[model samples]
Target: MFRALGAVLAAGLILAAAQVPATADTRAPARFSEFSVTPTSLDVDHPTATYTGRLVFTGADGTDQGVPGARVCLDKDGRCVATTETDADGRFSSPVTLSSTGAQPQLRDGEAEAFFNGDAERQSTFVGSGIALHVTQVQARITMGFDHTPSVVGDPVEVSGLLERQTPDGGWIGVVGQTVRVFVDGTRIAEGTTAADGTYRISTRVPVSDEGFWGVETPLPGRGYPYTVAFANTWQRAAHRTLVTGFNAAPEPVRKGAKLTATGRVMRVTADGSTEPATDYPVLQFSADGKKWTDLYEDHPNSQGYFSLSTPAERDGYWRVRTEDWPDLPSTSSVDYVDVGYRTAISGFNASPEPIAKGRRLTVAGTLKRDTTAWKAFSGQSVKIYFAAKGATSWTYEGTAKTSSTGHFSHTFTAAKDGTWRAIYAGSTTYVTVTGPGDYVDVR
Candidate 1:
């Protein structure tokens, strides 16, 4: 029984010894014979770079030999971003896509490392520092348009444009949801965000400046990326804030063939909200229908910024003053309307029956004529007849009469005492008012 227990114990010990694993061979130091990363710069246009290297070790015969079937990886920030295996020549090629958050690549220290883990016979090694890596921002461009190219101070200006970025294939694509800023004479005035289609719009008032120049810019979208500066095109002329103010045209009911005057002031608004006289010349224009205008006169404003222009009153029309079409300053004033009427006169005025009995009927008559190129009868006009007692200081309102188509007007009044009579035609928008010569009548 003792021999049987001892045999079983020996068998257990032999089985346990047999189950033990064999010791591994010592690892040999290995290195990358030729390791390089192609196109060290990465950008939105070219987001992928190539990593290539060869793994080698000293063989038992003291000669360098390839370590085949070994795994290689490209690491960034200690994390593998790409991996591949060595071929029969111990050469490996791997594509490294930058780790990105949104459209921005994650980069630190602007460097990368290519590494290999150890195997039973080869020790681990990596490409050391001094390998240059850069995260470059994509190339960008902008196109812009102004709602009012020559804008006035205190008025809003709208700017719109598109933002585009270059692609790897040398093509352009719109950049979405990016902030765009507007600058007037190097000062940022307004900002807006790009839409889904890369279009952006901003509205801001024209800032006061002695010399105005407008421009636009868009910074690179992501952090830790290098930028290439670019700006949109700007307007050609220096900005100006000039306007015509307090415009007037008179007389309100001017007669034909008479002088009509237009007056206004041309002022320049400054950055501090103060105004000064502008030396620019102003033009007086006339419009028959208020839609199309014709230049009537041009003259420079005085030191006080006031200008007066005169032209013969012709037909009814609108009048306005505007600054000359200067390269820097262009402005217009509010319009004024004028009513022009023909010159009118009373002719052949008389009161019949110079000597008459008491209570006799007295008749007063006259012809109303309007002058254009020539005199013509003006019809459908209201005329009044007045009477004054012979030594009376004031005339009495006797009666009213309308001129006929022949321009003739007459009225009858019963004369009870010695008096002087006259006919008067009141003026209208188309004809001038006139009073006829007085005729005296005596009651018998």
Candidate 2:
């Protein structure tokens, strides 16, 4: 245990000891020794982004030793963000890497202090600023594109890129007449000097057998990044892959909830009008009016590059096969039209007691059935009756008939002049409308 003041009182101070210098004290005194940072500069952009410094104190014998444990902060304010302990060399290192992204390029100031293990009193050593650091957001970037991706490997491809600077107003301006290098697999293959508009075009060959990434890099000097990336190889332009998609579906006029078999074939286009089977494939996709395309099912293609998917004819829509784009292959799509139709049937339309006298009652009967599923009877449908004089271009509305439970409809008409009679139904969203040629009725 450290000697306490109790020991000083045990040996009572006498008037004779007062004759000694006023500064004389039995206990040792602690004072600031040394405080400094190495390198005197920091780069906030580096990954190892941290600063190191040390703090020490002088003993009563004038020998400097590193403080074992001390409180440290990054500002003049006495708040300790961290605590540091000294090593055998009396040196303490606290990392100063925690900085905000917006911190500007400026000197950082700090202070350090120590506390007695069991005492409230404290000693402080201030750290004046000397280190300079830069904190900023990188503003230079590049944009580039290819004329056609998935081209034949080992063949020539047109590659282009542009060097640009992000302005203060959030706009971009081209960095004109700059030397840019093109790299493939980290090897410099070609170089292009920027034009007046900061754009550069280079014709290069495929670097790899299957595929290889190509990028644009700039060698800007000084405070900025020494090797900065302007563009990354996103599209494999030197590709030698092609995907041919084709699709077909039946029955031509399928009904809702009916089994629909969609057929498709995937081929690799080696040349114009030439193709080979594509073994690696996925299922088909379908879409309806006002709806997005969705996968038909998780069905892979057969070894012959042929795929068939059976899905319920749920709605009116179109089906297509989608070929995904990958490392060396370009994508493609082929569509097949599908119409879900309603099988509507009109029957039993006849007038009883033909040749009836005018103003006499005549009964007309019929039935309206729609093939929802194998010709189900549609009941409660409103049917309009129309009549036209014999040899007339158009018919005139006569009356209305409401269908019964069996889809049977009947209307009693008082025979008027000679004319024709028929029933017409307006279509609904799911069913097709039905119209019929009138049953000729003669008036005596």
* lDDT tens per residue, model 2, 138-171: 4668877776663565556677878776655778
- lDDT (0-100) at residue 354 of candidate 2? 93
Model 2 alpha-carbon drift over 4 Å, by segment: 1-254, 264-267, 271-282, 286-293, 298-307, 316-318, 325-344, 347-365, 370-376, 383-402, 410-426, 432-444
Which parts of model 1 are misplaced by more than 4 Å?
1-179, 193-213, 219-225, 236-247, 252-259, 265-280, 285-296, 302-305, 311-323, 327-383, 386-397, 400-431, 434-444
The clash number for model 1 is 0
Instruction: Score each candidate by Cα lDDT.
Output: 0.78, 0.62
lDDT by residue (tens digit), candidate 1, 94-166: 8877743222234422666778888877789987753667776657788888887645665667899998777
**Candidate 2: deviation at residue 418, Å?**
15
Candidate 2, residue 69: Cα displacement in angstroms equals 99
Clashing pairs in 1: none
Q: Against the true structure, what is each candidate's TM-score?
A: 0.41, 0.35
